[model samples]
Target chain A: MSESRIERGIGLLLSLIQYVTASGSVTVQEAAAHFGVPEQRIREAVERVFMAGVPDGAGDFIRFDIDFDAFEQQDVISVTMRPAFEDETVRLSPREASALIAGLTLVAGYTEAAPERVAALRDKLRSAASQGADTVAVDTLAVPLAAQRIRDAIRDRSVLAIDYRKPGAGTQRRRIAPVALNLNEGQVFVEAADLDKQGMRTFRLDRIEAIEPTHDAWPYALPERERTVTGSAQVVATRAAAAMLRDYATSEPVSVDGERVRLDIEVWSEPAVLRAVAACGGDAEIVAPASLRRAMHRFAVDALGGPSGEREQTPRD
Target chain B: MNRVEAEERQFSLLLALVDTSVGFTKHELFVRVAGYQGQPVGDALERMFERDKDALREHGIVIDVVQPPGDDSNQEARYRVLDGVLGSPAELQFDAEERDLLDLALRVWHEGGLTEESQRAALKLRADPEFRGGLPLERTPGRTSDPDGAEPATASILQPRQRPRESAFQALKRAADRRREVVFDYLKPGERTPRSRTVQPWAAVLFRGRWMLVGHDLGAEDTRTFLMQRIVSPVKDRAAKQPFEAPGDAATTALAKLEEIWATASVGVHALPGSDADIRLRHRRDTSEEDGLLVVHHADRHLIADELTGFGSDVAVAWPAEQRELVRQRLERIRDAHAEATGEAAS
Candidate 1:
């Protein structure tokens, strides 16, 4: 076909062969799925390998011995006789190496283990790929002391008492069975079973002013299904706010009709929903759920110190 | 040539180039490689050979062009793949624990643009006999074996928005890695026009949900952080007449500088006690209540306003007249929109 297609085909074949050689035996279906290609393409590539060899070779020609019976009956590709270079490891392309290096560097930043071990591993990967170590950099979010302590409690499976600052509620002592730690965007969240609330709750790590491991052991097993601290909200807004909505919304807008765009958003809390709506200024309104609408009206009236007509503007110098 | 023939030729060419220690000259390669065989020695063969070399290089195979030790002429350049460059080192091996750790580390890229590379690396590691028997790697969080309808709860669930053009990021990353300067037209957050800048890129960092290029702006004579999203023009590599070493903690320093900017710019808001607005704003780091007003530190006033607007009547911008006016305007608009929608519904 076209030149670049042929080039890509060869690259895919080379990578597939490398993978098969390393893994010993991989099914044709597995190969197809892993490389995100059609099964027929993988089969054709394998068939081509039988005809490919050194030009002047007598008995040492390169060949892949496929199990014909298994292939015909069960769609299994068992390479009976591996290629001569099967022992040779597949070399990474410079772009591939660079991408991996960048990824590893980012991982190193987030890792909580010994700094030296991560540093050594990063150096090894760089040297092996013939790439410089400092090519890619990442600055991980600084984990607070309280967050670190909470992490320790998670690993130890202990009950933790934290001086958590819940929005509007002020600081309060919370005892929770620390389950897991999650990082979303740049913020860290701790998923735990609030012993007092007796339900799953997510605490933003930064909001935890103080945390201590209670000597008591974990009282319950982690739930089979991890509860996500996110909910979807729909809103209609002006073009400017809609533009901002596109930025903050987790996904694309559900629908857009002129300046009013309907967006389905996943936010951490009900307050987060209110915060997002407020961020839009007054250009946006939550159109669905009559209950939420009433709440918004109340929230607005309260902030204004009365109804819209009589509300006084508390201007500050 | 057909697909099989083209690949066979390339494969034969690789075998020839890699087999020889001294490397093969142009004439020797044409005679030895299978694809070049049977073809008449002419421009056609030369063109095909050139294309093959490019294809191989694109796959990260480095073919070294070397002159025979005794010969001192530019002509008759010989080529060979360098030793160990394409092959794994014999001494390099990983135990079960290290392999597991690597498998875990590679998982971080599940939502990133580097999935293909990470997958290839994982396959490469799995190929080794020692690592073959290790525990099966855990699937990405959302794809786990948990019962259906169990919402995948990842702490860091928000993936960075995919950039419109990744080439800018790739170019900036390369320049930073090579210690080279780059020139590009940048649009500041609120500015209407773009400005050209020349800087020695120190580090490319992901901060506050965006990729930022931090570097020494030669014109401003100060370190500046440029948002990748706001880079209006393609990043062009500058001539490397002089290169400066990146500080050992370049990334950390750049992030600290961003934090400093946020710390210096503060805003004040009055939220009714026990309201969602008051609770959420108070929970934010570096925010405190002073005389019934919530004092918030932020990098972008517009961003803070966006947050405050979501609270409706529960919160009011207490200071920074510009931000207060912004919130006021937004609230009025929302109020007007709501009244219109309700009026239509009632009718």
Candidate 2:
């Protein structure tokens, strides 16, 4: 049997018992949502598991003595006679402790939270861990220097003129009304209203060349739309490249051989896919959408030089 | 046993053990415990008891074993839960502000391997009476401009919103915890082919938003740190001749080495003022300007090379002939791969 399931089950039961004991009385629905479990599982746990107890030496068992009457009719659970134990608060398993500690370590590097307080909290967590808290290490990227100024712009709701880098295109100057900063997939992005394009644009935080503060306030009141419009293309990827593309594959393998397989992948940006293909270093090829294939060639040619560069050669196929 | 029965058995066993003044022997437990009762006395029953002990220990319940004096063969032994072993102290408390910080940190792990771990930890914390009545963290006012009330810009800017994990992360972590050897295909930077590596995983460290596994590489017979993203194939556990013992401080050692590399490694680049590379590299942490060139500090050469390659003609590597060669090779491979067009017009 998978031990994780058993661990999860036991942890759930103990936590549920503690929650009900502490809350005095809680609805089954609320408990279900709180634990992210199904209502049926909660009912089963309460009705069949916690209602009973272990056997004592004197031919009698110590029962939890739950108020099953209220539970049956009102969807509420209450533990009347608690189990006979001192200090029954749940202790975190090693995995659990490591997760929290690692997360705290990362947050400490960039957050405005006081360093002393965070350190104290880490100590507290270390003490609470059953064992082996020190085995999991975490390090986070320091907040970029541009991040603080960007936060200030978002807070002030001010229009800022900035130079932003577009992949395959040189730096372009634009005025944007700053909104929120989003961190996704280890990269930071700023959601803003682009005045030049009259649309919302998400700019990579690292790609901003310079921020020129403007006194003008944000003028548009546009609601945020779907952040990305995914586009799909078919490609033949080597086993190595296929592994990287697995996350973006939209359909089952169109066909598979020993070495290469055809996959239909969906991506938010065509240029990003081109870059990924370029990173693969010829392990992947665009098999469909003639325009995209041509675009792939053009993307690489431009990266090397222009159409008139000395390296430009004839087609391979 | 099924899940429900197993859970009930463990809980009852824990309760029985904690309630006892003197621990119960294996035979006594099998005869008395509700779930263990009525089982025939045999090797299977003994294995079940041992497995139960392991499961309880995995859940952080420390079961103390009392043995007869000098009984090396374990002919007579009893098991019971030590006092105060099941939960943290009642006084292990957190203030409102501290809880708020913890809440934000815990919330950052979503849809990742650590998500469940964080949730389980949060549940344990919430079970404390001191934490009662703190159901939802209050949002700071005036920062709720998002229509859906997304996280405020301040919090988002200060922390990572995603873990950026690889497919082999969970497998590697489990293999490390179990002290098992794992085999996977790894593609190192600047290398076209992937190589199979067999290693005894020691610990996994999250450095710079990437999961890196620190382990003893069998082929190299030395401790090596591998970035998880470079693992190109599924991680498979290979039974070792004997379970390897991990160094207790493996994580700290790996982190110290990474920091050392980050401090010592330097690369020089030339970027035009107000250019993309200029802005990106200038604001990078630990970056400095020397001789009218940007000195970018990096932990790994190939990773930084990948970033510089993205800049195209806007930036050029100035020093460190090896790094310059790496970037040059990558650019050339990209160019060579597409140099031959398939009879198509430039789109």
Candidate 3:
């Protein structure tokens, strides 16, 4: 087998080994069938398993007797390898960690992956701080904290009392029946009764401040007209938000600071308290809303001008 | 390269990157190439871009320099490069089927949220070489039917293509290149603990989308499965005291086990008393079976408890065990603090 192919085969063997034990054995013949490899190739791969003890003192024998025939028939073989009673290995290479880190790193920014080349430059030297870091910060993306309570109170197929904050508008707190928790625009939205109107309206998670789940459960249809405004855009206040703002420090208006942009945003996030954080872009970008997030979408936007220069708006005439 | 040739070649690369189907604006194309050139700002270079575009077109290279939505007001029209016509006269356009698919996909994506990654992917698709046929439906039924030779493997700063096995090959290469016997931890399935093992590295490979390393464990005197992702703090570039040898186990391969790490990392948080049971959350909705239980997905029970504790006396953890006891204590403490302000806890 090619060196790379052998590596792949061995990796598969290790993954299978995770399921095997001193008392249990994964058969080679069955693995061959599953892998669509010859029995000998399967044996070569299985023999790569981490086990102790040797038959005839060679250590090359199936540390324990494995029933090859039974394995081929049943697709599982009994293991006889004696436990070595040693520690296991779990260290991944920088490259593998890089991939996983790239995937999960979005949990914080919640923004999707950036361009690959840019990601590589950013990923270089910036490994995930070990789980043993001095401090670990936390936050959420899909839902806000204040509304969390109200959302729970709604219960499934139940009536809800939402203390909602409107878009650059006032607060409306009322009890309403809820139909569903769905997402529109990658944002989680709730379809429930707009208590005053007695009609169903979709509330963004960010806009919900307080939720009271009543004991009553009922089913209702989502009003088709209100579907357009499905979910709310929420901003979270977190240490992660702060760290990201620091990263945003790079995109601060190039005109203002060599490395910074004038950060100001007007977002529709709610719960008054949660909106006050350092999220990026237009999500509660006030410098004072310490709890609010500062969001920046302008850089990524394909507009024609820098932070300065009035957008050449077409003459209304 | 002459102005015409340079522009033509640059557009060629750009077209290869983003298939003809997904067109790019002049600004997008310029920024992408500027990134390649380290932001060269000069009128001469800009002029070259125009000249080369025309030359490429004359050679039957259909490079459409398009000006996207945001008008720069240069009033000078711009175009984007697509397929190399090599002197053909037909302007390459999306056929009905390709147009339909693109429209539906774009609608779903736009409605979902203007996801930046999706947009980038779409933009890149426009210049990709794989977009040979007029539209995907014309030849094949499957969506995104780019012929094998035309597929564009995009790698950008924000979006890197870490295909399966790439990591494994890299790790194994590093190990072999350095000749090191490394030690690391492996989290197995149905188990709570991650154990450490010493390994003599032989090779690594990417099977699907993850890395797998095949190495001989010193403790086991045999080979084992090592999931590339599950490995932590790998100390690379060390020498192996012993030589390499093939293992003789008659069971699963090491590579498969490495791939199983995620599904196998059976981890449960050490539940503090408050996090032990289902907690009833009060939303402004009616109660249902699904909404009744509050699942604290956190691996840190205390952290979950702390969050629950924030609700003060309003929430309670139900059943499983008297899980609310911890929260109750917290509430009592808060209540006492308030009472001290008003002398209630003492009462």
Q: Which candidate leads in lDDT?
A: 2
At residue B124, what lDDT does model 2 achieve? 66
Q: Write the per-residue lDDT of candidate 3 for residues B1-347, one digit (tens) a residue.
A: 21322422343333333332455444444444422233354775567566655443322234555554676674444554443221111111234433323322322222111122222222222222222211112222233323232321111001112222122334444454345667665543212245677887654433323245666678998766455544533445456677653342211244344335423322121122222111222221122333334333322233234444443222334432323444344334333322222221111
Candidates arranged by TM-score, highest first: 2, 1, 3
- TM-score, structure 1 vs. true: 0.62
Per-residue error at B12 for model 1, in Å?
5.8
Question: Model 2 TM-score?
Answer: 0.83
lDDT of 1 by residue, B231-290 (tens): 656789976667687765666677777788777887777766565555556666678777
Candidate 2 structure quality by residue, lDDT tens digits, B1-347:
42337667777777778777788887778766767777778897788777787777766677888998888776578888865466543533578767766766675665555775676676666655444321222222233346335445445444346544477888887677667799998877556677999999988787766678899999999999987877877899978866788887888899999989999998887765666557777877788998777889888888787767666555667788787777777677555555554422112
Cα deviation at A258, candidate 2, in Å, is 4.9
TM-scores for all predictions? 0.62, 0.83, 0.26
Q: Can you give the lDDT of residue B177 in candidate 1?
A: 48
